[model samples]
Target: MTTGNFPRCNCASGALLQGVELAPGLPALQCPACDGSVLKLDDYRSWQPAPAAVTQPPHVPEIEDRPSARSCPACGRLMQRHRVGSSPDFRVDHCAPCQLVWLDRGEWPALAQAGLAGRLAEILTERWQRRLQNDEIRQQREAALRGKHGDACLDELARIRTWLAEQPHRDELIALLRTGW
Candidate 1:
């Protein structure tokens, strides 16, 4: 509840550690100085309480090996398998998970799209989402910045360069740069 340093237990180890919270009700926590996982007192207390063993719920795997044709996280329709870029071997699901595309078995094509403006948009959107910690001042500042910038304002220059280098059209994009477009 407080925004100050608090002692927590390391989930991995039973060590007591210090942690800080940006806001309440957030599951994520970061250590103050060590930058390690800070164990929560509630977790320790629960461990101490030792609740009666109950029937375990059915196990569900987080990720599937085969691609799902179901709706994407980004778009609400079925996600189709498509080669994102020049890499024909690299395949990803499109339009399932509502703008959230999944890269499976291929990392090259995934990295290639990082050169495109889409990566910048994703980064900006993520940054904006992170700033929404119920802190009015931070929220307002982020909102102001968001308003001042359009899609072009999102900067992924370094990432784009790295991705372009790994991509097939690296020379082509570089040539385009020489022509000033």
Candidate 2:
């Protein structure tokens, strides 16, 4: 029963909405206009700010200059264009400071309510998240192996670590390790 600006279906045209906490820790917002739903905090925090208009580092780039249609719900700053993943056409206005995303009227519903865009976004985001997690795990394993063994074994351990990390089911690997594999 907290109040805050939340992401809405861009298709809803700026409708005020309410959020319902479904479970102990899971909460989501329901758009009154389009009935679109989105996870509250986790989804909100995952949003990265759009790069500034000036110079950018190698991994980040400045988004195209576009007139903002709406202010960010979280920060009240003007939203800027942000491209998701490798899709050039999949752009949303994002606040650089607060990491809030503002979808134009109808954009949210078109992406979330219809299910196609939302599914794609969820799949892509999950894949990316898994990849990141795997990378972190791999790095940790490499660091541990390097510390215990020598650099000579690092490459061999890296190959095995990569294979282990890519396994869809990690329980077997974890159990094997727990048993002194």
Candidate 3:
């Protein structure tokens, strides 16, 4: 439900977004109903520092990550969801053609908390996305290995591997173990 020239939010409610000054010169169209914000990439790039002063995440940040894709308010194009990080996993929606971004409530503070608020542009890059995917796969593999080997055995094996890497005759020790007397 939009009035005048303000763009509408893509949230479930589809509320009209209101203009808000994110920083001194950074303006964004924020949804009054959902608290989401629509921001232009140019405005974000030119803006310095941030609008909020958050050194740490709130005790419980109100993050609502949207998994499904949504349409861009500026150009009516599909938005691409980019994973930011783990621990407190969330995705940012970017519309390349429109050069606009749809940030859900609490995403900015979460990014600042994760030390990635200044690198939003970098986060959307192919290299960064691939690295994040690789990290997730590595974590899954580690979890599976830990489950299969159990804590005690895995810990011993890890300790042994660390110790072996420091030894000068590590290869010889491995060979002797393989063909023990």
Candidate 4:
């Protein structure tokens, strides 16, 4: 429900939506009544940061079975629900066609606290997909190695590999091992 330039808050009807500046030039519609916010994708995407370096395996987010979906303030359409990070409890809504996002009370702060505010676009890219595939492959390889070699041999092999990886001649060592040296 919308009236004039005011976008209605889905959390509570009759709540007046106010224009707020989230950053220097980014504007968002905020509901002072319930603390919910509506941000356009283009507006929110302006704050996107460079993709962070992944040191280890990607952390999989724990998704919960949340049934409720919010309506988009821009189009009155049912917004798509998405989990922020590893926490399944918190969810935000996005209307793809309208390019609008709805954040419930405290969701914005939660995203910021999780360091996900500036990296949302990066997480949905092809690089992220490739990382997930690599993680799956690594897990499968580990399971197979453990099953065939047993824990002791697998542990020793892992230690040896770690040492080899640290060596300056790691590529040469790998090449030699592949040739049955």
- Please estimate how well model 4 matches the true structure, expressed as its whole-model Cα lDDT: 0.67
- Residue 181 of candidate 3: its Cα lDDT? 57
All predictions: root-mean-square deviation over Cα? 21.0, 14.9, 3.9, 6.8
In candidate 1, where is summed lDDT lowest over 10 consecutive residues? Answer: 48-57
| Candidate 2 segments whose C-alpha is farther than 4 A from its true place | 4-14, 20-26, 34-69, 85-87, 103-181
- In order of TM-score, best first, we have 3, 4, 2, 1
How does each model score on lDDT? 0.38, 0.49, 0.78, 0.67
Report the CA-based lDDT of candidate 1 relative to the real structure. 0.38
Candidate 4 residue lDDT tens string, 1-181: 2335445676646577888854445578888877777777787676543333212214432333235887777778888776554444576777888877777766665555566666555544557546656776898899998999899999998899899989999999899988966
For model 3, how does the per-residue alpha-carbon lDDT over 49-97 read when each residue is reduced to its tens digit? 6435335555535887776787887777789988888643488899998
- Candidate 1 deviant stretches above 4 angstroms: 1-77, 105-181
Give the alpha carbon lDDT tens digit for every residue of 1-181 in model 2.
2445454444436766567532233344555765434343345444332322112222322333234454555555565554433334445555556544444334443443333333333433446546656776887887888889988788786678888899987778878877975
Report how far off residue 14 is in candidate 1 (Å).
29
lDDT of 1 by residue, 1-181 (tens): 2323333422233344433331222122443333332223343223321111112213322222243343332234565655333333434444423333333322322333334312312322434334433355665665677677743553455467778889888888888988967
Q: Which stretches of candidate 4 lie over 4 Å from their true place?
A: 1-6, 47-67, 123-161, 167-181
The alpha-carbon deviation from the true structure for residue 171 of candidate 4, after best TM-score superposition, in angstroms, is 9.2
Candidate 2 versus the native: TM-score? Answer: 0.32
**Model 2 residue pairs with clashes:** 9-108, 10-105, 10-106, 10-107, 10-108, 11-106, 11-107
lDDT of 2 at 21: 34
